[model samples]
Target: MIAAGLGCRKGTSAETLLSALAAACAEANISRESVSVLATGEIKRHEPGMIELAERLHLPLHILDEAALKQVETRTRTVSKHSLAQTATPSLSEAAALAAAGEASELIVARLIADGATCALARSKDHS
Candidate 1:
């Protein structure tokens, strides 16, 4: 399964989130329908843009805690200073994607940034 992990500024619009997702997927040469899930930090569980994005995608939104995010932090290719300071993780999108993609997963796309959001893609080795 493939997962898209996202991070966005507070109060970001759903359109902005969708644009970011599209750009990231385009860079990865994958369609939006290929994404099995959306993932983000638990702190964003109630974020309007996130909620809207998941609803529009018709995919589950997996919320990862700090520990889960940290598990994949070292695997992130991109670094966001603000994300490091705010979330205590170097790359929210990459880390969250890895976390949600399940065990034995690796990042297929590094962090991609748009106007107000960031996205990364990860794919799992265990298809079963």
Candidate 2:
């Protein structure tokens, strides 16, 4: 599962938080459906973009209160603070490997994560 939390920053914008989520998902080989993304802070503020991302990627996103998110975020690494698309795309198998030992599931998650980021950026830009 890919997990993301907006660390050390209060009132961080949804775009910024989503960027971190996208980055972690890229590295972990997780997708919207295969993984559950729990975002810290207010979902209402992020509803438009989050919903759009979920629909495009077919992912289920849960926006939790900060305190609750923190409880589960203790051990996970956030890695890149920015989006992962600017980096080179991984091969199908390579991307899958990051997800799990299972070949088929990994590839699906990787592709969805990558595609979800694209949908997010596009949707956000349109709002801007």
Candidate 3:
């Protein structure tokens, strides 16, 4: 399964978030339809943009708490200094996607920063 992890400002628009995800998909040469789920830190559970993104894609949004993210942060390909301070993880999007995709998942696309958001893609080898 393909999972996308996201990091965005509290009031970020869904369109902006989608644009970031699209860029990640393009970089990975994968269609958005291949994404089976969306992941983000639990701190964003109330973010409407994230809810909208998940709804629009018809995929589950898995909100991983800081603990879960921390568990997999080391697996991320890059670090976001801002994210590190905010969530105690190097890359929120990368760590989130890796955490939600399961133990055997690997990053297919590193974090792609956009205007007000960031995104990364991961695929579960167990499913692939």
**Of the candidates shown, which would achieve the greatest lDDT relative to the real structure?**
3
In order, candidate lDDTs are 0.90, 0.33, 0.92
| Candidate 1 lDDT by residue in tens digits, 1-128 | 99999999999888998898899889989898899999999778899999988998788999999999998888889889989988999989899999999879999899999997999999998972
RMSD per model, one decimal: 1.2, 12.9, 0.7
Better of 1 and 2 by TM-score: 1
In model 3, the runs with Cα more than 4 Å from the true position are none
Q: TM-scores across all candidates? A: 0.96, 0.35, 0.97
Say which prediction, candidate 1 or candidate 3, comes out ahead on TM-score: 3
Report the alpha-carbon TM-score of model 2 versus the true structure. Answer: 0.35
lDDT of 2 by residue, 1-128 (tens): 33232221324444644564566565555553434433323433354655554455555444444334233222222222322222122221122122222112222222223323321110111111
Off by over 4 Å in 2: 1-23, 29-33, 36-40, 43-47, 76-128
Q: The CA-based lDDT of model 1 is what? A: 0.90
Q: Ten residues in a row with the worst lDDT in model 3?
A: 79-88
Any idea what lDDT model 2 has?
Answer: 0.33
* C-alpha RMSD in Å of predicted model 3 compared with the true structure: 0.7
